[model samples]
Target: MPRAALPPVLGCDFSSSPSRRKPVVVAWGQLDAEAGTVALQGFHSFASLAQWQEFLQQQPAWVGGFDLPFALPRELVSQLGWPSDWQACMQHYASMARSEIRTLFKAFCDARPAGGKFAHRATDGPAGSSPSMKWVNPPVAWMLHAGLPRLQDVGADFPGLLRRESARVALEAYPGMLARELIGRRSYKSDDRQRQTPERAQARAELLDALQQGQHRLGLRLLADTAQLQTMAADASGDHLDAAICMLQAGWALAQHAAGHPLYGLPPGIDPLEGWIVTAPLSRP
Candidate 1:
């Protein structure tokens, strides 16, 4: 089938509290899987969570990779006596305020050993994602709290979690997975303008070059015009490029689905209450 006939794909770098300065950035594209290419078309920045929700509601059918945890650690959930079932668990989690969550999670971490601070979902180990329970730094726990409820309310088909009748699909993604895979541990972005040094800009440029050259494990080329490429390179925040990384990861999973793996290459028997990160290997590849 022509790529146009397929649903549009997206990679979203979500923000728990978005403002005009730091909006939720999304990279929109179409994947030509057989040809092993992803055409990055444009970017969308939602200044508010409500604006992001509106976009999700309007998308009739699209496969998206979102940089947020879809679920929490099963260990954490069980220990807290939260609902074990995925949907029920989400509902229970969604009911809590951020302060309550931080307090409870802080208590949980405080009880553990010095090195072992937060609880980790299965996917975190393999994907190298920050623990979803971390309320500070990246504040991914807040991200999960903010993003997951919207996804649930939108009624998209969340593979391995909730398979709805709708064609809209969402998968957990970590842009760093691909970045680390291709570029090792080099830091490519920084939120602080002072930290966005020439070294980081060079690193971002190298990452874009690698992506365009299809030098990664997924064997997918990123198609972008000159201006778009420059824009991704120029953004010191790296949100734009992160969104594209997510889009490529989503495309890889979609390719897997097209080739007949129902889980979209996700391992069988993964913990449903702690969702898998798409394209993250169970071990180093």
Candidate 2:
């Protein structure tokens, strides 16, 4: 039996508090499943969550891989006595104030042993992502708090979280998973101008090269013009590169779907309360 064709994909680098200084960046592109190629069409940056939500609402019929946690740890959710169902949990989560969330998470961590304070989602280990409950030092929990609701509001489909929407599918993405596979902890881009040195720039170049040459096991090559490459390389914040990596992940997910792994390679029986990360090795079905 043959699988369906792939659709357009989006890769988003989100911010909990987007502004002109650090806007949410979205990379739009298409994947050639047969050719195993992904092309970067362009980028869009939104300085406000409202604007981001508006764009998502306007753009229909595309699969998106967003660089944000889609759910919190089951352990954390259970301890908090929140709803166990994903949609219900998200609804409960979205209704809370940020201060309330912070206080609860803080107390949760404060009571635990120092080294084992943060509860982790199953995806966190494979994705090398920070615990979604952490309020600082990456604040992925805040990202989830800010980002997931927008997807829900727009009626986007997220496997195990929301009912499948035929037009708009959303998947959780982490660029670090793919980046680490290529460079093995080599720093690529830094938000701090002082930290964005020649070495990091070179690392970015090397990563781009690896993708172009199809060095990864996914065997997907990235296609971008010289100008686009320069723009991605010159961004000191690395948001552009992260978005591109996420786009590739979206493409991979599409390919996985086309190959008959309908859940985009996410394992069956995964905790519905803790959604899986796309392409994470531990997430293989």
Candidate 3:
């Protein structure tokens, strides 16, 4: 079967803190007909962890491209001396509050130098992601600390987690990795009413064009109509939409796993579930 006919379940735009900020919105699309090609299927915006949890409970299984880092490096895990096992380690980490995680990571970074404090993967910079464990700036470190625990609590069927005996929910993804390759340092989103400049709009438009053309190695194309791309670009806050596009890119990479990519893509000695991104089952536990 062709990639497009595989059923539409991937592509997610996430809010790192859905409980406080706007909900995570997922836009799903696929090639609809034999000749018509990719079409927008449906979109879902998750309001709360509970709402996402509910979705997971009902859906059982489908791939999603979420905006969160999928896994922390094994080197960092060992340095922290957290549980070596994935599940136990994540459970332990999840029990702590966000402030606690910040303190822990902050203390570690303080010991190192400003130049070498934060550990990084070879892929981090290309992906335009904050250090998976950094608490400051983008605060992705806290995000993993915040997001992973919830995934554990929900106990979705993560073959990746089960395989590694780690409950961390490991997923290897960074939409920016692909996005920047197409448009470098091009600002495409803003929450500030004053900063929504024409440059940003042009950036968004260019990105949409690139995606439709399959400019990235996605191999598959985004079969959106011109109107759809314009609508998505028009949203002043295209961050979520950009994230959704990234998610879709990641989803394509994931489907490739069936053919050759690593099923979990966890680094050497890392547990599978520790950082995987997944769709919430449609029903709640």
Candidate 4:
């Protein structure tokens, strides 16, 4: 039988408190690994979470990458006696206000040593993601708090946690991991004007060049029209480029699924309470 057609893929650069000044940016694309290319379709920016929610509901079936933690640290869950089940745990988490989350997570950190302050999911280290419990300096905890409920409400299925008949499939994505692969942990874009130096801009330019030429391990080049490429490059926030990275990760997962890996390129036996990051190498311990 011929291979089934792949769904349109997306990558999201989400904000916990989205506003006109800082919106959630989504990159839509198509990745053809055999052809060694991923074409950028366009972008959709949502000024409010409700706007993004509406987009998720109205769109056709898709496999997308979301730049947020899908689940919390298993150790944190066990320590706090939150529900061990993924859905139940999220329910417990979402019920709290951001202030309450800060207090509790801070308390958890206070009791531990400085270097080992945060409880971590195994994938955090391998994927080089901030702990899902972090409430500030990226506030990934707030991201999960804000984003997961929307995914859950959309009736989307996450591979490790759910396997229902659904039009949308959601995977955890970390653009920094892929960026590190391309640029080796170099600073790229910045939200702060003072921090957005020429050096960071140079890094972003180089990353785009490498991605366009298929210079990375995934062996997939990015192909965007000149205007779109300029849009991604000009935005010093890096939101556009990050979304593209997420799309590439989703594309990689889609290829793995097509190749018969059940977890859609996620590690086998990933903790349901701590979902895996897409496209992270299995070789990392």
Candidate 5:
């Protein structure tokens, strides 16, 4: 079968409490698979989850890499007596109050040993991410709580979690997964103005330079104007840089699909209840 034409791609830096001060940042762009290039069109910030959901519903066709966990750990879900199926689990999860989620998850952790308090999904180690059940610190659990429901409501297609629909494909993406590949453990950005130092700015510059120079092994080049590059590098929050990195992952996934890896490089045995992160280095059992 002839491959479908590449659609627009998006990278989203999600926020559970999306406000004017800390909105959800979305990077919009297109991928030129033939040239192995990702041209960043622009960035948009949504001050509320409603606005973000509206945008997703409005877009007819696109592929997106969102910096949010698409599913929880199967162990956690099973322990909580939630559905083991991805879609059903998400639906059940979305219906609960944040307080209830916290209470249940906390109870689970309270029963576990100190060193291994959290139950992790398979993708956590390779992606170097916090467990999806973590409610504090980064609050990735809240991000998942906020983001995945919007995708489900919009009827977006997420491979492994749902059947592949040609209109909109949503993939789980972690900028850290790609960033660590290029710059290992170097702090890049900070939300606190006091912590946003020259060192972090330099790291962002180095990261952008590497992407422009095609230093990443993904074989994709980021096409951004000088002004855009400056803006991305100047952001102390690192949201823009993360979105851009996700855009690259989206490009890579698109290229993978074009090259006939229909699951966009996801492993064949990925756990159905815990979706894998795109472009993460897979570890063998």
Candidate 6:
């Protein structure tokens, strides 16, 4: 059978709050195969779940690389004695607020101070992400807690939760997963203008340069213009960079699709709800 056409591209800069005070930033693009066109479709800051839901309802066919942990480790779930099933597990997680989770993790950590505050997966190092269920630091744990439940509630097709087909695949992605591959532990973003020194500027420029030069395993070139780079640079929140990195991952996924890899070469058995990085597929000898 012939392969399906590549899915439309969606990238998100997630915010757990997602209220008017802290809206979720969504960036979407469409890749036109024949023309090799990757055009920005829209950017939205959704203040309510309904708004986000409405947005998803309109774009049901796009495969999105969202900057949120798609799942908590099964190890954490077994430790907490929560149900192993994805929907039930997320329901339990969605029941708790950020403060509640913070308190729970704090107590858990306090009880085992000698061991350390919280457990982490190996990907956390390269991805520069906090544990997917933790409340502090990068707070990605809370992002999964907040975001996955919504995805579950809406019956969104999370690659970790639902099976992958042709129309949509919601995968967990950290742009840092790609960025760290290029510049490990290098700081490329800062909210403080004074801290945005020449070094950091060069790092960002180099990162963009690498993408333009097709220097990564993805082997995809960024066709973004200088104006787009300036706009992405002006984003102090780091979401724009995250979105751009996700765009790179999306491009890589398209390439993988062309190579006839199932599920875009995503590893088998990643938490169906929690996602994984867009690294090079492990090679067969």
Q: Write the per-residue lDDT of candidate 1 for residues 5-98, one digit (tens) a residue.
A: 6688899998999999999999999988778999999999999999998998998888999999899888899989999999999998889988
Which TM-score value belongs to model 3? Answer: 0.78
Give all TM-scores, in the order shown: 0.97, 0.96, 0.78, 0.97, 0.96, 0.82
lDDT of 5 at 170: 94
Better of 2 and 6 by TM-score: 2
Off by over 4 Å in 4: 283-285
The residue-by-residue lDDT of candidate 6 on 94-161, one tens digit each, is 88777877777777777776856676654555555667767766777777876766665555565436
Local accuracy by lDDT, each model = 0.90, 0.89, 0.59, 0.89, 0.90, 0.67
Better of 2 and 5 by lDDT: 5
Tens-place lDDT digits, model 4, residues 130-172: 9988988888999999999999999997999877788699999
Kindly report which residue stretches of model 3 are placed more than 4 angstroms away from their true locations once superposed.
Answer: 1-7, 19-21, 31-38, 153-170, 258-285
- Give per-residue CA lDDT, model 2, range 10-88, as digits (tens): 9999999999999999999999988999999999999999999999899877888999999989999999999999989
Q: Give the root-mean-square deviation of each candidate in angstroms.
A: 1.4, 2.0, 6.6, 1.3, 1.7, 3.6
Deviation in Å, model 4, residue 60 alpha carbon: 1.8
Which has the higher lDDT value, candidate number 1 or candidate number 2? 1
User: Which model, 1 or 5, shows the larger lDDT?
Assistant: 1
Better of 5 and 6 by lDDT: 5
Check candidate 5 and list the clashing pairs: none
Better lDDT candidate (3, 4): 4
The CA lDDT at 165 in model 2 is 51
Worst 10 residues of 5 by lDDT: 276-285
